[model samples]
Target: LTVGPPPTPIPNPQVVATDFLEVNREELQRWVRGEPGAFDWSPFIQHVCKIEGRGEPWQEKERRLRGRLRRILPIDVHCADPLGAPLRPPADALLSTFCLEAVSPDRAAFGRALLNVGSMLRPGGHALLLGALGESFYLAGAARLPVVPLDEDDVRGALSDAGFTIRDFRSYAMPPALRTAVDDVQGVFFVHAQKPLEG
Candidate 1:
């Protein structure tokens, strides 16, 4: 998606509702405030630019991202409890990264969470998920937090069970240098699944 500027209001422009959920709201707030060294998103933006063949400078991209963040207020923060407190008005698409695997203790919980998240989307809506694969635990500061080691099959099965059709999926093995840096994750996966249209 092109991250230039928010589109101007047109006569009946398509409305795409969105919401933010985080296990730790404070961390998200810190990142929004542009705190020093808070969640570096440059690498991700650069990667996308490379793939899309967009040669925009880093400064411009950062400016656009900051502008978008400025629109977020405290009221926008929502609890990460997928099965409990869900956002209103539902969403057309949901993007989650590195959160489900970190919080889900096992495969069952992961499936449950997937279903819960799917519930937040309207029929025919899409969900994009990215998470570490085959990772039992990851280091958080000085303590080790648990992660459910999941493979591609596990993810595909869970998504299917959660009433989603897998549209796109990919995986990448962790590099040797990065593998030993923090977590013992074997690989990472990116999945794009769509809910079935209403009959």
Candidate 2:
């Protein structure tokens, strides 16, 4: 929860896996660099304002960024509840990404979500995923959520259904304090995939 200077050795994949979410900022920046016309950062910019407790500036900036991104990229950026309701990816979207913190390890649900990712993204878009490593316990607010450990084969199957080729997939271990000998392996899955870019 505390954001400090990055640790040496990068703290392995588990300790710093949460850092993946923060990478969104860099991804957005990169998108803008490549296609400023398609860049829309209103959503994230608004979130930043909320963090700073500044409303007016946040609104103005959000509006402007949304306009800019919409102009350049034919993409729809939204804050969606994937579990509450089903959502589909854009057929024309060249790149799509998702980050799920609380997801049931149910195979059916996972399969559906992965299929949705493949269905929405056009050929040659990336999907980056971060899941709680191993079966671990964590408190959300006050309630504890137990993570169900996922192996590489399980992850690969889901990606295959989504018509994606796994470019990279790995398991990460959390800090020793979070680790447990048996159930609390404190591992997560990071997978990067891309749909075939058909010529």
lDDT of 2 by residue, 6-100 (tens): 84552211111111244554555555465555556567777888888855687675544434552122111221332223323333323322233
How would you encode candidate 1's per-residue C-alpha lDDT over 39-98 as one tens digit per residue? 877798788778877788876866666655432222221234443555455667787888
Question: Which runs in model 1 stand beyond 4 Å of their true positions?
Answer: 1-24, 30-40, 67-85, 175-177
Number of residue pairs clashing in candidate 2, backbone atoms closer than 3 angstroms, sequence gap of 3 or more or interchain: 9
Question: Once model 1 is optimally superposed onto the true structure by TM-score, how far is the C-alpha of residue 109 displaced, in angstroms?
Answer: 0.5
Off by over 4 Å in 2: 1-101, 177-185
Q: Pick the candidate with the highest TM-score.
A: 1
Worst 10 residues of 1 by lDDT: 70-79
User: Worst lDDT window (10 residues) for model 2?
Assistant: 10-19
TM per candidate:
0.72, 0.47
